[model samples]
Target: MESSPQVYVKAPPPPETLGRPFELMDHHGQEVTNASYSGKWLLIFFGFAGCREACPTGLVSMGAALDALGGEAGQVQPLFVDVSMEEPDITGLAQFVSNFHPSLVGLIGTRAQTFATVRDFKIRREYAMANYSTKETGPRINHTAYLYLVDPDGVTRAYFDHTLEPERMALTVRLHMKRRRTSP
Candidate 1:
């Protein structure tokens, strides 16, 4: 009997419908919509101010990824959307964002707007009373920690897990940019 060689075929991925339109206020108190950042790519992460672990880790990684991008970093706008139900003032949001990248913008919206954005992003979030809860210390928010990459044309190009390395993240973004540039 004679043996035949086998071939493998891969199918294209389904189109993503991950992100949606949002209207929020920046840390600077400026109103912004999804279309506000029309000419630049958006790197967005959703987390709360009270998140002590995952949020900082994700933000740091995101900052490092932007740094790794070097000149290409200017074309990307990094955003940290506050998903907490509690209202944090502009000063606090400004301080929090300053701790991350210089260009990282913190977004906060009304409860309804935040809820809509969270739902649109399909983020799973919950609030749990902390073990060391005090009058000042509120319930901690637990939410999904995925990073979203949105292209200039307001399309979600890709998303990355929290654990991905900064260098790898930058490389992935670079690849996506290259593909977009070369495509029709």
Candidate 2:
């Protein structure tokens, strides 16, 4: 028997490597497209309502980061994309994100719509086949954790992982905003 060489790879390229377009409804039932964010910066994250660890913490850190920016926050828009399979409507998305930040906009759509966004964003997600509610723990859906910064031109400029601090995040956002302002 012959052996073949195997290669190990991680996730897809960083989200900033691509500028995919997306269209989804906000919590208020308003349709928001890539163009809607034109002329402003967009901070986007994909997570579900039932996420107990990374999602909520990321949202909190984002809100704190924006707060740290003070007036500069107005130059950016924070969007929490609810990619949870459990939430099929805008109401659930709204209620989920409301607990974190007042200004954070929660986005939701049909399963197909959400799946489309997930695919475009290159977000990795997995569904557990076993029902954990019957056990000591609850059901779990795994997803990627990354905070993306999109420029006014609908281009992704940066992405942050779990180790990024709020202060650093805010500073990076300000620098990007400044660069955008200086550019033609």
Best by lDDT: 1
Off by over 4 Å in 2: 1-15, 133-138
What tens digits encode model 1's per-residue C-alpha lDDT throughout 57-80?
899999999999999999999999
Q: How many backbone clashes does candidate 1 have?
A: 0
All candidates' lDDT scores? 0.86, 0.81
Where is model 2 poorest over a 10-residue stretch in terms of lDDT? 130-139
Superposition error at 157 for model 2 (Å): 0.4
Worst 10 residues of 1 by lDDT: 129-138
**Candidate 2 on 1-184: residue-level lDDT in tens?**
9999898887767656654788888889999887887777888888877677788889988998899999888878899988775546677677888898688998887788888888877888886676653421345667888889998888888888745899999999899888887988
Estimate the Cα RMSD of every predicted model relative to the unseen true structure.
6.6, 3.4
Task: Evaluate model 2: give its TM-score.
Answer: 0.85
